[model samples]
Target: MRLLVAFTCLLAGCLAQKPQPCASPALMTGAFTVTTQNEKLEMYCKYEYDALGQRMRVKQQGTYQTKPFTRDYLLLFREGAMYQIFDTNRTCIKSALKDKFHPMEIPKDATLQGQVVLGSPSAPGQGLLVNTWTGDMPDKKGKYLSTVTEFGCIPINNSYQSDEYGWVVVNLYDNVNGIVDPGQLNPPDFCRDTVMKTDEEPKNFLSLFHNLP
Candidate 1:
């Protein structure tokens, strides 16, 4: 009787599939590079997480060029603050983060559109594509700051990842996963002698990558 009951329980467990957790930062650790279709706009980024799986540090560096103009910069984020080091002006700017940023996750109420294979069609891994219409994410001030009308996400290996947003399409490659040195997150002392920016500066470095008319 014991063997029969155990076998029945195992069969029932296999029949009922449990819902997987959304793309929580707990699953993401280590380093990744943010790259675009054009190599000239490639950006290197590294992510460091604490014991609780919350992001503790981030280091990003890249060179942005548009024809005759080019600018190189290094960005570091940690302890609820961001530091930007510009190579052209030899200046370091600091900005404080008002709220903690949680990576986008697929909502429980999302509508499943379909499933698609990432990378190539013959790839062994597949992703579930979902769309959230009523879900609108506001900026820090509770004001609707983004023009992104459609919110789409693909959950692969139980993680919400997307390759395209608005008019930008890029690939995220994470090949490094290990301990990050503490010194990498620190700004040089020379930056202190240079110009300093207040916390009210622009929030993102989007303007560095492109030239808007």
Candidate 2:
């Protein structure tokens, strides 16, 4: 089955952070799977952050084991713009959102939740910090959008969209702490050409990463 990658189109400034939130600029590589009575779909992803605590790059690739077709795409966020690279056809699209960072933006009136849970006792004073919130956003047309999100303090469990994917759960198996290879954040030569809307481009690819997911 074709996986429907869904996420919020973030277009706002930074949401206020609670004290001692999870560390960032780390690498989170994992899979998002959705299963229902009638269909099942899965996608693998690698998310990277820059030293400045920003989501600098993300690459997602996957396909059904029995299918011949595959989907692969990379998104680079920097310089106040978002760059997309479609792996199948080596096409690039650019969107200048003028926002440097794209973490999910929580509404001003969103409900807040968090706690300081202790970690391993051996590591004294070390504890797990968690922040979860939910809120609603009305689009320009006045359509209300609802979202739920969770963030980890240690960056171990990290963060994921609780509401973006219906019946989908994001499980991250590998968490790498270090600087990401510069090459991974750069657009390849094939994608350096002018942007063009071709018939082969995936419609949701750009829409998903338009904000900070």
* Model number with the top TM-score: 2
Residues 2-104 of candidate 2 have per-residue lDDT tens digits of: 2111111110111233533223334443334222222233445666555444445656544333332333444444444456667667677765533335443
Q: Residue 119 in model 1: shift from native, Å?
A: 6.6
Regions of model 2 farther than 4 Å from truth: 1-39, 51-55, 63-70, 76-101, 104-110, 116-129, 137-167, 176-178, 198-213
Top lDDT prediction, candidate number? 2
Give residue 28's lDDT in candidate 2 (0 to 100).
42
Q: Which stretches of candidate 1 lie over 4 Å from their true place?
A: 1-21, 25-79, 86-91, 107-109, 116-135, 139-165, 175-178, 186-196, 199-213
Least accurate 10 contiguous residues by lDDT in model 1: 142-151
lDDT of 1 by residue, 36-124 (tens): 44444445555454424333455555544432332333333334445555655656766553445455354455434433222332222
Tell me how candidate 1 scores on lDDT: 0.39
Structure candidate 2, residue pairs in collision:
22-153, 102-212
Q: Could you estimate the TM-score for every candidate?
A: 0.45, 0.48
RMSD of 1: 9.0
Report the poorest 10 consecutive residues by lDDT, candidate 2: 5-14
